[model samples]
Target chain A: MAQIRMETNLLGANDMLAAKNRRIFKARGLLVINLMSSPGSGKTTLLEKTIEALRGRIELGVIEGDLYTDQDAMRIENKGVEVVQINTEGTCHLDAGMIEKAWSRLEHLPIQLLFIENVGNLVCPAEFDLGEDIRVVVLSTTEGHDKVLKYPLVFQQAQVVVLNKIDLLPYTDFDLNAFNRDLQLVNPQIRVFQLSGRTGEGLAQWTEWLVEEVGKRVI
Target chain B: MHEMSLIAEMMNMVRESAAHNNITRISRIKLVVGKLTMAMPHSLRFAFHTMARDGLFQGTELLIEEREVAYQCCQCGEKYLPDMPYGQLCPNCGSKASHLLSGRELFVEYYEGDSGKGEENGANTHGN
Candidate 1:
């Protein structure tokens, strides 16, 4: 029988690269947010709305991650903002190495706020650290309320939870109170904002929070 | 799953270290996982077993050491462990202003196996 002896972390390589990315962000004084959610959860819509609202106020850039297609990147670029598209090429999530590669292309832009739209998968995205100032998880009313309970790790790791597509609340049976309770049970410290990106309802609160958070990191 | 990617990285590290020291066989591996991280021991083991085959870690024992979450209250200076399934108020000071001290860690502490000498007994090595 062959014998092997070792002591090493499964995430050691990812963590090392993440730390390097964090150092670069810190050096640039950039406020990076890793945005995560399930498919069709309005991440790109919210980004469009956010860019529109804070275009002149904050220098913004984006890194769009998806399994395939540069559709989201095209949408962001149409808004006249700096953006990079990363096709995970069938992978479910984006890692620090992928972000680092994207940064090489977009880092030359004058950006103060960087948004990384992670691939829409709740489980895998929560595991990798992308060296962001905040990890925001987006949840839409159409996806139901049990998501917070079933995926506690995402909620626990997130600093903020954005409840998108609130305009459709009238048509869907989404219990806001129950969702809040479940979210708090998972992470009491998480700041949650319920908003609709399509109609612009409740976008002010999210933008305000983003402004405040970004303000704190600016030199 | 991301576990597969992580396992591949771990095996790479083991192989590099073994080659550097001129060691041929390994017996056991020890790793510490924090409760706050999303890593599952069962899933990690399954993935490790699948990836370690035909590698330097081929018949190695996977040993996992769990580290619980410890928080200290910013107001009252109280320290305690939160309940499993996590996210409960601090029982000691009833303050939510607690700072996390541990449970975010993921690393290897040490290993016990051959010393590359013809003699089978040697001192164990630890890596940070």
Candidate 2:
């Protein structure tokens, strides 16, 4: 028997769909963001705050990925943005095909930005690309500094790292300097925004950065 | 786990390639897994063993190779191996290089299987 040489990516099918989604997004001049983080990292709250900040500056739509209910989708809908909820049942992450289906609902909404809030898991979500223009990983200050080092794969791919719940830093042992150093090791050029979803401290910097990113891609 | 789904795809690939190349039974399969991925070998093996019980793929030997993460220096334009397994520091120029040369891969490399022209022992699909 001879050895057949074939280099086949296991995620090739999903990646093909992701490429198609990217092309579709580009043709429509829309920017999609895949927001990821661990459970209890306050990603929903961060999105709420972000939606409030960019209400009039840029039109927004969201596709919320969760295992069970449409809780986050409801939260996003309360912010006056069109939202779609995808229940993965028990899947740990969201794939490009899910986004492809979700986009159909918001296809004619005249929105400029789409946020795919991936299921709250650090490991699996990083493995799949959902045809997003930007990837952001939200890590709250209470999660500790070792998260950047432990979950390097997720942090490395993120263009922006959101350090939320800074207002609670006083009660937690989370070290910002150490966290930055770890993040630098993973990705030296990662843009970091230290903010609080509850107190709104440092929200302006994050919102300004978001607006700038949208402005850069809006055609 | 995602590995389960990925392994299912790998099995499909093996079958399709076998049917295309006129092979009946695949005996050995080789896969290259990256260091940055969260796939544990045991999990993949379990998934493979459990799924290979089907008629298309049975008792297939799976070989997995773990790859190390490498980074390319942006300053000196050189690719140097880092001291540790997962850091992005450029060992050559000591710069904060953003280009990741390797270590985000998960793919099937090679496989050996039963071809046609013999006594047609389970390889009759080849139609020799």
Strongest candidate by DockQ? 2
Over the stretch A35-114, how does candidate 1's per-residue lDDT look in tens digits? 99999999999999999999789999999999899999999999999999999887778999999999999888889999
| CAPRI category for model 2 | acceptable
Using all chains and alpha carbons, the TM-scores for the candidates as numbered come to 0.83, 0.91
The DockQ of each candidate is 0.28, 0.45
Model 2 sits at an interface RMSD, in angstroms, of 5.8
Q: Which regions of candidate 1 deviate over 4 angstroms? A: A1-9, B34-36, B53-55, B64-84, B91-105, B109-123
Q: State, as a TM-score between 0 and 1, how close model 1 is to the true structure.
A: 0.83
Which residue segments of model 2 deviate by more than 4 Å?
B76-79, B115-128
Best by lDDT: 2
What tens digits encode model 2's per-residue C-alpha lDDT throughout A1-219? 656777888899899999999999988888899999999999999889889989888899999999999989999999999999999998888999999999999998988889999999888899999999999999998889998888889988899998999999999999888888888888888998989989999999988887887788777
Question: Per-model TM-score of chain A alone?
Answer: 0.97, 0.97
Question: Best candidate per TM-score, number?
Answer: 2
| Whole-model lDDT, model 2 | 0.86
Model 1 lDDT per residue over B9-49, tens place? 77677767767666666677777878767667887799889
For each candidate, give the TM-score of chain B: 0.83, 0.81
Estimate, for each residue in B1-128, the C-alpha lDDT of model 2 and write its tens digit: 77777788788887888788777777889999887887878889998998898654676899999887777787888786667447777766678764777777799888877764543434222221
